[model samples]
Target: MKSIFDQRRERGGGTREAGPDRATVLSISSHVVRGAVGNRAVVFALESLGHQVWSVPTITLPWHPGHGAGTQIVPDDTAFEAVCRDLAGSPFALEIEAVITGYFASKAQVEASAGLIAALRRTNPDLVYCLDPVLGDEGRLYRPPEVLAAIRESLMPLANLATPNRFELEFLTGLGAHDNGDLIDAARTLGCPQVLVTSAFAMLSGSIGNLLVGERSAELAEHRLIANGPNGGGDLTAALYLARLLEGQSPEKALRLATASVFEIVARTARTGHNEMALQKEAASLSHPMAMVQMRTLAGAKKR
Candidate 1:
């Protein structure tokens, strides 16, 4: 098979024109043929915001596991490594300003991704890598322990920011995140310069929060809890948040927009009784979300 570099050269040696307004992003995640999860949610959200995405799928599934068990296909280790190598050596690799990774299918894939990130950063030091550690949720371990370890050790150090849900934060830091204070402490311990903790405790009744923990500040974006909402909320949140930041929005502003967009999509999905996120039908929300997200300053948040 022709490598990615070879394929690109055959078409043209020039980088793909994304227009001056759009930034290029490389997104690596799972791909579900039937649901809006993993790369499906991420690629659509980024592209909806007028960004070009270089999507790489770690695993392929018929649909999300929540719907039912389906055939899972993961590329062999050598094949995956070869693809990563091709991308890293491609002339257009420098066009990528950001990378978002989630749902690695294996430990080898995690290492391959880390290697690609390292190679990209060597040429573009300003590269932003968002690590969404999709291990498990609701007090359970969905991925193998080795996969979790690879993320913590191999990928965490290369990440500019991390979006981990409350459960994932605890698993990564080995610390309890029962309250906002605990969440902040755990975020710091995780060693990421910036961290966003979703599914955080909310001050208002019947609401959930996304907490942003930075070097010197912390904020929470809270919205109404939509019960029985469709899957892929976190995937969408991580993607949009990165997109907003790439657009030069402040951390606080980015948090608000990402939180609002996800909340809007979740509420809409629930109203329609859909099993998956209606991201395609609701693509406008990714760019112009009208949902209100209550933002608050977390007092006494420690500064490092």
Candidate 2:
């Protein structure tokens, strides 16, 4: 039987012989048993888009702490490194075309992930890595300073793209950006080929935007802001955006699609009065999002 990816490619008038039907992605992040945050959201979004996913949980939680305090478990640093080394040496390492890292519990986990990415790149030189800097939101840093430092020094340099929310971008750049233009400048300074800033300022009131900044161009995709939305929108956006890119979508299109998917799912979750995303019931939103997104080109910042 043809794989889901293969069937989708055929329907899209593509042949498997032209290229691989789908990419295999390694997702490293936190795991929650009762919520769709971190790897739970990332892995589901990727697989729903027809890509193969390998998930590694940096830490495990019974549920997101936003609900209340919960039990958390983090693997030993040495053991985490050992597992990463094992994957690096495995035959499947050559098959991974992309990796996304988020929410490391320790600086050591960040280092281990960096080592794994380096190893995978040796076999697949064109590997795409998206760093989702899961620092605190609302003008504070939730992660330890050392872990943030490791991400800035070690992982940022290795990433092809980065997905940071407005606050996290400020944390990474050490420069406060009050508007989209300032954000474009700060994003460029990160030196990543692509940076997608979520929670960007929207021209339309009561809406949110995702700003995609590149070397020479920028685009914004805006959608209605669901109030008190679920926790995994960033994870879903990063995963869906990467999946779209792997499927050969342009950056602007990927931004629109990803934004639409997240918005749609969040809207669904809100309507159902759920605190977590209704990803299991909203698979169609991930694969074929019908939500309308307002897309517009933005003026790139002048180079210094």
Candidate 3:
């Protein structure tokens, strides 16, 4: 087992020991240096779950993006492709059991990601590719329109699993956003084997809304709505879901674990008014969330 000190030091400055493969999961997404969002939370969650995580920061923003600050661009397409190629030939190459992607800062990144997915699949055909398509929200297009079109057509189809919010789901599926409509209808129309939606509040009543985690067939159990959370929390949610998938967990169990993990972190975020990706503190104090009345009640039902 790799010690905590060794793992942190090895990133750039350590002469240290190598850890076990145990199905390494690569976390690729936009970077947030000064603040939190996207890959920050998801990668942290995956690490917390004891998975060996390799991260690729796609782009770096100056501040919290929710505040509408601009971000800086990194290696162009050629550089990005070179990095992917390098990874494919590296020692950790064989351990990449999955590649989880989010927030493509440019069209080049999207194309490179698609290529990496192909390369990873070529080596480990069973490698799970989970894509959290960060296209846009609530009918708003976040990236360029062409990027949206590329994700809808080129990128998403290659994913074994893709976690998209309701707004993003609508844009990808051509179904307009409707709060009361059947989630199954949306899932079926979307065409992915499994679809986990993060924002679907109509299933819950007043006080706070719920998150619906659904699967295709009747045999698959439905994860009832979960506690409230802020935007970009989906990054954490998707990470948890992917970790479970990589662990060989069943669809139903994956959903349950994902729900439990997300709600636990969200409760802390809610209290602290912090970014959704801020799970470092909460994950450390997981006992508190498990002991919460609401979480405990939900967990009790699960244990039953």
Better of 2 and 3 by TM-score: 2
Q: Across residues 1-304, which tens digit of lDDT does each residue of candidate 3 receive?
A: 4322123234332121223323477888987765557777767777776677789988877765776758576667788878988887677677676788998877877887788788778887666778899987766878898888888777778876778877788778776545424444655565565676666543223322223333324122223343444556678778876766555555555566676566666665776766444566668532123422121111100111
lDDT of 1 by residue, 168-208 (tens): 99999998766899889889877777799999999999999
Error of model 1, residue 25, in angstroms: 0.5
Q: Provide the overall lDDT of each model, using Cα atoms, as 2-decimal numbers.
A: 0.89, 0.88, 0.63
> What TM-score fits each model?
0.93, 0.93, 0.78
| lDDT of residue 90 for candidate 3 | 74
Tens digit per residue, CA lDDT, model 2, 152-269? 9999999988999999999899888888999999999999888999999999999999999988889999999899888889888999988887786778888999999999999999
The Cα error of candidate 2 at residue 289, in Å, is 0.8
Cα lDDT for residue 77, model 2? 98
Would you list the clashing residue pairs of candidate 1?
none
- Backbone-clash count (model 1): 0
Sort by TM-score, best first: what order? 2, 1, 3
Each model's total of backbone clashes: 0, 0, 0
